[model samples]
Target: MAICKILFFLLALCIWCGKCDVFYKQVGDEVSMKCGVDSNSNIEWKFNGVLILTIDGKSGNRRKGLSHIVLKASASGDILKVPRLETRDSGNYFCRQSGKQHIVHVVSVFVKPGPVLLQSSDAELHCDITGDPNKEVQWLRPNGQTYNEKNQVIHLKSVTSNEAGQWTCLVKDDLKLSVTLTVVGLQTTAVNASKGDDIELPCSLPQSVFQRVVGGTWKAGHLPKVSFPTLTNTPSKILHWNGKDLSKVNFTTGQLSTNFDVTLKNVQSTDEGTFVCTVEFDGEVRLSVETTLRVVDKHSGKTKQHLGCTLFIRTLSFILYGLKLWIWIAVGASSVFLIGLIIVIGVVIQRNKRMKKRVRKLRSMRQPLTDKDYCQCINSSYNNCYSVIEVLQHLFF
Candidate 1:
């Protein structure tokens, strides 16, 4: 009876010690829990409240009383095992001996997706997550499958309109924490051509957003394909169409007095069509304005011909009038000259006749002088002779 009493006391002491000690641990790490009891003390082990191992004796008949199970106990009957870890390897574990019940120690093990690296034709995209413990990152397709390594980069090779869409990245941790990554594909704006006899179509992107773009693409209606032209220090001014094909039309000069002007040289009737002007910055279109052109026939040639005819008639009349006036003056001057010449000739002829009459009168007067002289001379000379003769004649008569 005294020996039975001592065994009872030892059993009670073991039970009390097992229930006193309990602890916890995290997953993917080691699990070390101890139930402090003297090495000389008899003990047992229970996992999850189930009796699995115990120390008892019936002499060499230890096999009949939980001896077949090996319980590698520490000097203190402490339990330590690295529970071959898995996501489900988390729960309460316990160690008990005799009629004593010990509360099981517990730990939580969580599993999450790992970091993902995505590759694309042009560039690369790195995916990651942040949490208490860094979470797992994954790249997924729309179908919920992992993305191919080559398709990871943000910039895809030979980007086309069809290659435009949304991309996603998913992140998760043991706590079921999740994050979403959104990637938007680049887009191209529409370019419009103005309608008119001669039209200017404008291609421009928004100023604020355009600076971010590296380059853009352009297209026209029912025309052969042409790529977008890059803009330099000078932006592309205008786009034009010759009757045959589309052309990179520019202003006659680099600048324009008007908003945007393109002069058509020798504009033909067919030149009356729409013109488009597209301005690009960076790699995007920015601003656009459309203008209509109407071509009208000018009457310049007809007006000039009319003016020339009028001038010719006026000049001809003036010349004829001048000639008539000149002829009248000449006739008057000739009449006056002829009259003066006749008067001068008549005066000269009258003076010559008078001179001839005076010369005849002088010549006629000398004859009478000669007769008187002869008479005197004869009388004087005869006087002497007459006395003698007169005496003789008187005697004779």
Candidate 2:
């Protein structure tokens, strides 16, 4: 009986060692592998080629373990179980039966994080990672503040002058990775001024800050570096003087002034050039803005007066010429009408005289027949009679 029991145990061990199989499956999926001792015969299961599990009334040592997953094995030999598989669960696994051995599986799964935008007004930065395991993300500010939030995204609420600096993002996992986020500030206003006048160019800050005026310096036409002196009780209003002599330019208010305003008294035409404003802050000189000053003569007033006078003279000349043209036309028309009237009058007078002479000649041709008619006709000589008749006719007509 003892020998028979030992032989039965040896036969069972051989059957359990003979069945081994391995295969691959995706994460969050069911896993199953065939375990058989012989053809048309069920067998037990072994994990990693050593431990065994029984199936179909066969018994063996049951084993269960996990690398990065929950491993579960039934007393049944044909199946090995894994629950809630992850990226780290991807690896070699083994299954066993009677006398056959096979690699159970090698699994590979992928997972990726969403894209994120790290942006500023002057610069753009991005951070992304792709793998089976989620990556840890971090961001560092120029002020030495570290941010390690797990939202797959990070956004700056608003960019300010103080936020203008280098930023870094660190991704930690099986492999460590890093990216940079650069935040730059935007300039809202441009600097400008006129020559021979007091000018105050303001450098705008973010709206959050209460103070409107910030500290800044002046650079003149690519000249050498000159520090901006502090404002004091005496000559503090003038930031810089570019004229011939600094002593002549009055700055009783000292060098620096509040409100970033520069005053120039008695500014001259020669003090015209480009001026650059630079502000030192946040451990370095960040921004350099430029403006220009030009001295121009006040000729607009004179030009306007001259133009007004010229227009008045032109208008007067036009009126006079129009009047002269009208006078000449009137004189010409009167002369022509007068000459025609004189010729017509003379013709009419000559016609009347001729008619009178013809009438006298006709009268002279007539002969006297009776004594009374002869006496009436002999009252004057022929020429005298004709003249007297014409005179009478002229008076009567």
Candidate 3:
């Protein structure tokens, strides 16, 4: 009893000085605290120096506290129950004798948060309860598994690809604290594919996170742009590959949200570039993956730039060979035609010379004797001289 008085006096003094033992409780929780005095004596309860309730000897000292506080006393000092604690419930609480003296227990209530958000890594979560520290706390994971870590502070030691979700901590009286943790970031992958072969750009969601993805889009340098719908079987496209109405690129989803692979049919050197996939998560977060497509050709094991010189050289040689053949054909035809023309001209010239010789001989034979010509006919120089008749005709005509 003396110890009870001392404790009650100390509690009253702390309340007057605005200091008391703290009891942390979650929201929507009922706190039943133990008292250290006799239950039949008159007891007084004060909050922040204001009289809240009093159990006098007239009321048999078995009365409860205020509408929010429950006091059920026994032969010894019983417990004081504060139900449905809220933020306003956090303050100095004092219990002592009303007029003569009863028993008192002082407690300062602190309300912990119910919902929290944590980043990817370098994070810690602390949970507190109003009861004993030796008792284990119930923890509910996002995966629906119950965990009893028995720890006041939990540390997310390492993080990869950024983890985020809802975590819960549960104490007695159906009280629950939840945290929404979100970690967002990006990752990259490298892929090599040969020209004219089909390639698949990998973009898959695990079973745990497949349902969380609402929509996504895929784009590449040479690939046809395609966007998948959160609903419906057909994909929305901007342009089809290979200049056809149908798209050579296909965005395929798994039967059960287990697979998401983009197929590029007949991949060419032009199809080599970075392919990006962006997925919308929970309508707020965007997760992306970048894949680099490296298309290779076995021909010359080089790019088209290097093959340009070889192709040019081959094409020039072929053209020159055809031109040479045509030139020879033309030259041969011209030579044949020129030889035939020269022969005909030579024959006509010889024929004309013969005709002129015959005319000259005939004129000489039919010529009337001219004096000079007759004298020349006797001489060797006048063998073909015109006769006198031809000379007279020439002179008369």
Report the number of the highest-lDDT candidate: 3
The TM-score measured for candidate 3 stands at 0.35
* TM-score of each predicted structure versus truth: 0.23, 0.25, 0.35
Query: Candidate 1, residues 138-172: lDDT per residue as tens digits?
Result: 45544466656522133334233333233454432
- Residue ranges of candidate 3 with Cα displaced over 4 Å: 1-36, 39-182, 193-198, 204-216, 224-246, 252-261, 266-269, 280-288, 295-397
Alpha carbon deviation, residue 258, candidate 1 (Å): 21
Better of 1 and 2 by TM-score: 2
- lDDT tens digits by residue: candidate 2, 294-341: 544435566457655755555544535457544666778999999999
Which 10 residues in a row give candidate 3 its minimum summed lDDT? 109-118
Error of 2 at 132 (Å): 18
Give Cα-based local distance difference scores for all models.
0.38, 0.43, 0.53
The predicted structure with the larger TM-score, 1 or 3, is 3
- Per lDDT, what order, best first? 3, 2, 1
